[model samples]
Target: MSVSNTTDFTNPSTFILLGIPGLETAHVWLSIPFCTMYIIAILGNITILFIVKRERSLHEPMYYFLCMLAITDVVLSTSTLPKTLSIFWFNSRGINFNACLTQMFFIHCFLAVESGIFVAMAFDRYVAICNPLRHSTILTSHVVASIGLAVLLRGCILLLPHPFLARQLPYCRTNVIPLLYCEFIAVVKLSCGDIRISSYYGLFVSLLKNCLDLFFITMSYTQILRAIFRLPTKDARLKTFGTCTSHLCVILVFYIPALFSALAQRFGQNIPFHFHILFANMCLLVPPTLNPIIYGVKTKPIRDRMLWLFTHKRT
Candidate 1:
C-alpha cells in the first residue's frame, strides 16, 4: 500500500518496479494457480502442526523439531506468498518504502528461524543415532523448548537491524523493485547512492546465518552416517536411515535453490532476474507445501491415521 506523502528522493512521487518485464498483463490470471497452490501448502503445514500437537505418540525430540519446522515454514511461506499473490491478482504493486522494509524484516526473520530449526533438527538426529543412550536426557521437552526460544530470539536479533540499514539509505531512484514482492536485494539495489556498507552487512548476515547453519547440519549428518554404519543389525541401520530420510529430503529441497539465489545475488554474474525470481520463490513455496505430505502422508503410521480420519475406516 502507498504511504502518505513519502517520496522517492530521486523521483519524488513515482516508483516503478520494472516488474517481470511483460507479464504484468497476465499476472492477474496467474494468481488463480498461485492461490490454489498456496492454500494447499498452508493447509498441509497446518495439518502437520496439528498432527504433531495432537498425537502423543509423536512427542519425541525429532517430532518436536518437526513441529517447529512446520511453524517456521508457515511463517516463511506466509511472509511473501500473500503479498506476491496480491500484486498478481490485483495489479496493485503499491508497497511503500517502510512497508517494504517490514516485509524484508519478516522474510529474513522467518528464514533465519527456519534455518535454525533445521540445524537443531540435525543435532537431534545426531544425538538420536550417535549417542542413543543420552538422547532421552539430552533432548528432553525442556531442552526442546529452550532451543525453540533461542531460535526465535536469534531470528529477531538478526533481522531487526537490517531494516534500519534500509532506513539509512535515501531512495533517490526509481521505486520499482523489479520483483513482485519486496525482495531485500532488489529493494536495496534501487538506492541511487552507494550501498557498499549496506551490501557488506547484508553479505555478512547471509553468510553468518546460511553457511554456518548448513555447516552444522552437515556435521550432524556426517556423524549420523558413521553411527548408522556402526550398528550391528541391518534392521537397526534401516530404522536409523528411515527416520532421517524425510529430514534429509527436506534439507535438499530447502537449501539448494536458496543457496543458489544467495550466490546469484552476491556475484551478480548476469543471471536472469526471471530465473532468480522463479527459483527464489519456489524456495519459499515448494518446501512448506510438500514437507507435510512428504513427511506425514508417506509415513505408514501417519498415512493410516490420516486415512482413518478421512474415511472413518477402522483397522
Candidate 2:
C-alpha cells in the first residue's frame, strides 16, 4: 500500500478519511461505481417518494410507510455519500465537532425512524393477515398518524442527548473516522476522554429498543404463522405467507447486518476495518436502496400501477 506521505493524517483540527483504502491513486476510476450506486439510490428513492406523494391511488398504510422509508433512504444515503465524494475526489475530509454532531444526529434519527417504520410495517402486515375483515378499520388515519408520530418521537428523544456527550468531549487528536459517515458511535469512539457515559447511554437506548422491537416483530410473525396454520385451504396459507414474504426477507437483510455490526462494534471484535466499512454500507444500502426493488418485484400490482402511471403521465 502506497502511503500518501505528503498528506498528513495527524491533523487534529480537520480529519481525513482515506475514503476507500488504496483508491487515492485511481480517484476517477474508483468513484465511478460508487457514484453510480449513489445516483441509482437517489433516483430510486426519490421516484418512490414522488409516486407515493403524487399518486392519489397509493394512499394506504403500506404506501405511507413505503414513502417514509424512501425518505429515510434518501436521507441515509445523503448523509454518507456527499462526504465520501468530497473526501475521495476533492480530499476535503474536514468536519468540525458541531457539524459532525449534526450529521450524527440526523443519521441516528433517521435510523431510529427507519427501524420504527419497519416494525410498523410488520404490524401492518400482521393486522392485514390476522384481521382481514377489520384491517381497514384497525389501520385508520388516526392510528397511522399516531404511528408516524411515535416513530418521529422515539427517533428524536433517544438521539437528542447524544450530541451533548459528543460535542463536549475534546477531539485532541486525529478526527479520522473509519466508516464513510459521521456515525454517532464511530465518531464518539474517537473522543479524548473516557467514553463510559456515552457508551452506557448509547447502549441503554440500543439494547432496550432492539430487544423490544425484535420481541414484538417475533410475536407478530409467530401470530401470523399461527393464523396461517389454521387456514383450511392451501391457497389461503400461501397467500397469507406471500404477503409478508418480501417484508420478512427485507427485515432479515436489514436487521442481521445491523445486529452483527452492533455486536462487532460493542464487543470490539477484530473485524477488519474495511469489512466494517463494507457492512456499514450494506446495512444502510440494502434496506433503503433495495426496499423499493423488493416491493416492486414482489407486488406485481404495484409495479403495474407505477408503470401505468408513468406511461399515462408521459403521454
Candidate 3:
C-alpha cells in the first residue's frame, strides 16, 4: 500500500495494525498460545507480588527489587498483549493516533524501567555477596526508594520525546503498521516525512537503555564472581553463587531475546516479516512468563514460600 508523493495528505486519524502480516490465516490459531501466555504472565507476576507482600521473610531488598520487576513485567506485557489478542481473535486492528502513541510510550517506558530494575537487582546481589556485612546498611529503605525514583524518572524523561517526534512527522505514506502492537519504529516508519531523527534517537535510547544497563550489570556480576571465588571453601563459594542464580537466569531470558528482536527489526532485512513479528511477540511474552517461574525454582525462599502458600490454600 504505497501512496503517491503528489497526493496531498494529512496525518492519519487512525492507524491500521496488520497483526503478524503474512499469517492472517493462522491468527485465530495463534491466539490460543498468546492468550495462554498472557494468562500465565499475569497470574505468575501477581502471585509473586502476593507472596512477597504476605511473607515477611521475603521483604528484604532483593525481594523488594523482585516486586519492582514483577510489577514492571505486568505493565510491559499488559501494554501489548491485550491488543494483540484482540487483533487475533476479533480483528480489532484500528488504533487512534493518540492511543497508538500512548501505547508506544507505555511499552518503551516500562521496557526501560525493566532494564533499570535488572541493574538494581544486580546491584542488590553484588552488595549481598561482595559486601555481605554492609549490605543492609548500603541498601537502606531510603536508598532503595531513591533508586526506584531515579529509574522511573529516567524512563519517563528519556522516552517522552518519542511520541512528540513521531507526531511531528507527516504520515502520508501509509497508516498500516505490520505489527501486533504500535511499536515506535513501525509507527514512525509509516510517515512519509524524514525519519532520520526518529531512527537515530531510537538507536540512541536503545544503546543507553540496554547497553549501559548491561555494562553496569556485567560489572556488578564480575565483582560478585570474584568475591565468590575468594570464599574459603567450595561449598561456601557455591552457596554464595547460589543466591545470584535466579537473577542471572532472569537477566538472560530478558536481555537475549529482547536484543535479538530489536536487532532483527532494525537490520534483518531478509528475514520473513511474520517471523520477525512472531519473534517480537515471543520476546515480550517470554520474560514475564518465565521470570516468576525461574525465581520460584531457583530461589529457595521463594520456592518454599510458594509451596507453603499452595499447601495452605489446599488445606
Candidate 4:
C-alpha cells in the first residue's frame, strides 16, 4: 500500500527527534554520562591539538595527520552531542527543517572527512614503514597540504547532495526522527514520496566512503606488515609494529562499532531498537573519546609532552 501523498500536504516546519526510545524515564541519568563523554572528547581532542601545535618537535607528518583527526573528532562530536544532550536534559527536541538538514549535513561531512583522514594516515604509515628513505620526500608539507584539501573537498562535495536531496522530498510522514540525531537515511525514511533515489544514494555513499576506504586502509596495513616482516632483526620488527599499535587500536574502536551498527540496522530484525540506537550513538561517541587516549598512550612524544605540560604548569 502506498502512503497517501495528499493526506497532509502541509509539511511541518519543525521536526522532533525520538532519542533512544524506551529510555524516557532514564533520560536524565543518561544525560550524565553523555555529558561526561562529550566533555572528555572535546577536551581530549583539544589537548592533542594544543600539544601538537605547541611542541615543535612533534611537528611532523604523523602529528599533522593526528591534528586533522582531532579537528574532525571535535567537529563530529559537537555536531551531534549538543542537540542530543538537549533532547535528553532540557526536553528540547524541536528542530526546524533547515536546522535539521544543516546538522545532518555537517554530521555526515565530518564523518567522511574523518574516514578520509584514516586513509591518509594509513598511507602515511605505509610510506614511513615500506619506503622509509622516501617518507619525507613523499609526504612533504606541500603533499600534506594537498592531501588535506583533497580530503575536505571529497567530503564536502560528495555529501553535498544528501541534504539537498532530503530537502527536496515531501516529508508527509511523522516529523519524529528515530535516531539521536538527524541521520540521512532516517530523515529520508520519513519522506512520504518515493525514496528509492535517496536510499540508493545513501548506500552508494556508504560503500564508497566506508567499504572502499577500509579496503585501502587494510591494504596499506598489509603492505606495512609485509615490509616489517622483511626486516632482518626481531627488534626492528617489534619497534616498527609498536608505532602502528595506536592507529590499529583506533581503527578497531572506530570501524568495529560502525560496521556493527550498520549491519545490525539492516539485518538484525530481532534486535532491540534501543540496542541499534545506542550502538549508533556509540559509533559516533566512542571514537573521539578513545582516539586521543590511544594516541597519547601509544605514541611517546604525545604522552611525554602531556606529562611535561602538567608538571610544568604546577610551578
Candidate 5:
C-alpha cells in the first residue's frame, strides 16, 4: 500500500517481471520443461492446422471450429512464452510498459477468443447431434465465418479497455511484477492510487467472458446429451456421442485449470503465492499442450490423417 511519491511514471517506463521468484537458481532446469512444453504446443497446433487445411474432408463446421481453437491456442501460448523464455534463458526480465500492455492485451484477448470458440464448437456439436438433419444448413460456411469474426471482435472490444485502464494509473510504486508474464492483474497490482475501477472491470470482464462461455457450452452439451440418449439404437447413440468426446476433453482441460487458477487468485490468499503463480502458468500452458493431443487421439479422422501424414512422408 505504501507507494513511492516522487517516482515519475513516464520517464523510466519499464516493468521487471520476476519470473518464479526464489527459483532463480533453478531457472535453467525449469526452462527446459517450459521450453519443451512450448515446442510441443506450437508444433501440435500447427500440425492440427496443417492437417485441417490440407484435408478436404475436414471442411465442415466442426473442423472449422477446431481450426479456430488451434489458431487461438498457438497465439495465446506464443504471446506469453517468448518473453517468458527470454527471462529464463537470457535473464532479460525487463519489459517496456507499452510492450507489457501489448502482451497483456493479446494474452487476454486470445483467451477470450479461445473461450468463444469453445462455445461455438459446443453449438456445432449440439446441432450435429441433436438436429442432424438441419446441421449443415444451420452451421453453413457463412455462419461459420460470421462466428469467427464475431469471436475476434468480441474479444478485442471487451478487452480493449483493460490495458488502457491499467495504463492510466500512476505507477509510483515498485515496477516489479511478480509473475512469469505481464498479466493484467499482476500489472494492475503494481500501480499506485485507487484501482477499484480497474479491478472491478477486470472481474466483470472475466465473468462476462469465461462464465458466460462456460454456461453456454454446458447448456449446449446438456442438450446434446439429451438428444443422444433419446436415440433408439445403441450404434446410433455411440456414433453420435463419439463425435463429442474430443471436444469434451478439450473443455475439461481448458476450463478446469482455468477455473482453479482464477479461484486461486481470487480466494486462495491463504495459499502459497508460488502455488498461485504456478497454477496460473499451468492454466495458460496445459490447454495448448493437451488440446491437440486430445483431438488427435479421440477424433479418428484426425488421428488417421496424422498417421498418414507421417507414414507417407517416410515413404
Candidate 6:
C-alpha cells in the first residue's frame, strides 16, 4: 500500500486496477472460470441473436425485447471482462484515464438499459396475458422500436455525467482503483476533492433507475398474475402463466445478483474484499451467461429453433 511520490496528483495519465484486492495470489486460477464465462456469454448471446433473427415466427414484441437484452448483455459483459482477464492473467493493470471512463460509461449505461429492457419485457407479458385480444396492436412494431430507443436514451442520458464528473475531480490521491474494473464509485473515491456531490449523484441515479424499473415490473406482474388466476380452467392458468416463466427467471437472474452486489459495494463495509469482488464479478457474468440458456430451455420456440440449428448443422 505504498504511495508513490512521483505519481501525478492533479491528473494522472493512467490508473492501476487491482483485479481483486485480496485475491492477487489467485488471479491466474480465477481467470479460468472468468474466461469460460466470457466465452459462454458471447456465444450464447450471439446464438440468441441469430435464432431470433433467422426464425421469422419469433418476430414478436417479446423476442424483440429479448434481442435487445441479449445485445445489452453482450456489450455489458464485453465492456469489462477482457480487461478483467488481462488484469488477472498478464497483470496488465494500467488503464488510461479516458479508457477507464469509457469502460465505466459502457458498464453502467448498459446495466441500466438492461433493467429497462426487463421492464419492457414485463409490459409485453402484461399485454399478452392481461389484454390478449389487443396485444399485437398495443405493442406494435413502431411502439416496440420507440420503447427500445427510449430505454437506450434514458440509460445514456442518465450516465453521461459520470465520466465528466469524474474527470472534473482532481486526483491528488493515489491513482489506483482497487477493483476489477473502473467502477464509478471506486474511481471517484480516488479523487482528493470533495466527492459528496459525485457520491450522492451516483446513489441517486442508481436508486432512481432501479426503483422505478422495479416498480413498473412489479405492477405489470401483479396485473399479469390477477389475469392468470381469473382464468376459469386450471389448465388455462398453467398454460398462460407458463409463457412468463422464462422472462421471470431471466429477471430474477439479472436483478438478484445485481441488487446484492450494489448493496454490498455500498453498505457492506464488513464484507471481505475478495468476496465482494468475486460476487460483483459474478453479478455481471452470471446474467449474460444464463440468459440465453434460460430462454433456450424454457421458451419452446427458442428451444426448437436452437435444436433445429444444431441438428441441421450435424446433418
Per-residue lDDT over 141-230 for candidate 5, one digit per residue giving the tens place of the 0 to 100 score: 999999999999999999999889988887876788889888888888877778899999999999999889989998999899899899
Candidate 4 — which residues are off by over 4 angstroms? 1-9
TM-score of each: 0.90, 0.88, 0.96, 0.96, 0.95, 0.97
lDDT of 3 by residue, 102-151 (tens): 99999999989999999999999999987889998999988998998899
Writing each residue's lDDT as its tens digit, candidate 4 over 214-259 gives 9999999999999999999999999999999999899899889888
Q: How many pairs of residues collide in each model?
A: 4, 0, 0, 0, 0, 0
Clashing pairs in 2: none
Q: Tell me the tens digit of each residue's lDDT in model 6 across 122-185.
A: 9999999988899998999999999999999999999999999999999986888878899899
Instruction: Give the per-residue Cα lDDT of candidate 4 at 247.
Output: 91
Clashing pairs in 6: none
Best by lDDT: 6
* Candidate 1 residue pairs in backbone clash: 10-172, 16-176, 17-176, 17-177
Q: Which parts of model 5 have CA positions greater than 4 angstroms off?
A: 1-12
Candidate 1 per-residue lDDT over residues 84-149, each given as its tens digit: 876776666676666778878988888899889999999998998888899999999999999999
TM-score, prediction 3: 0.96
In model 5, what are the clashing residue pairs, if there are any? none
Clashes of 2: 0
- What are the lDDT figures for the candidates, one per model? 0.79, 0.77, 0.90, 0.90, 0.88, 0.92
Alpha-carbon error at 104 in model 6, in Å? 0.5
RMSD of model 4, in Å?
Answer: 3.0
Q: Rank the candidates by TM-score, best first.
A: 6, 4, 3, 5, 1, 2
Model 5 RMSD, rounded to 1 decimal: 2.6
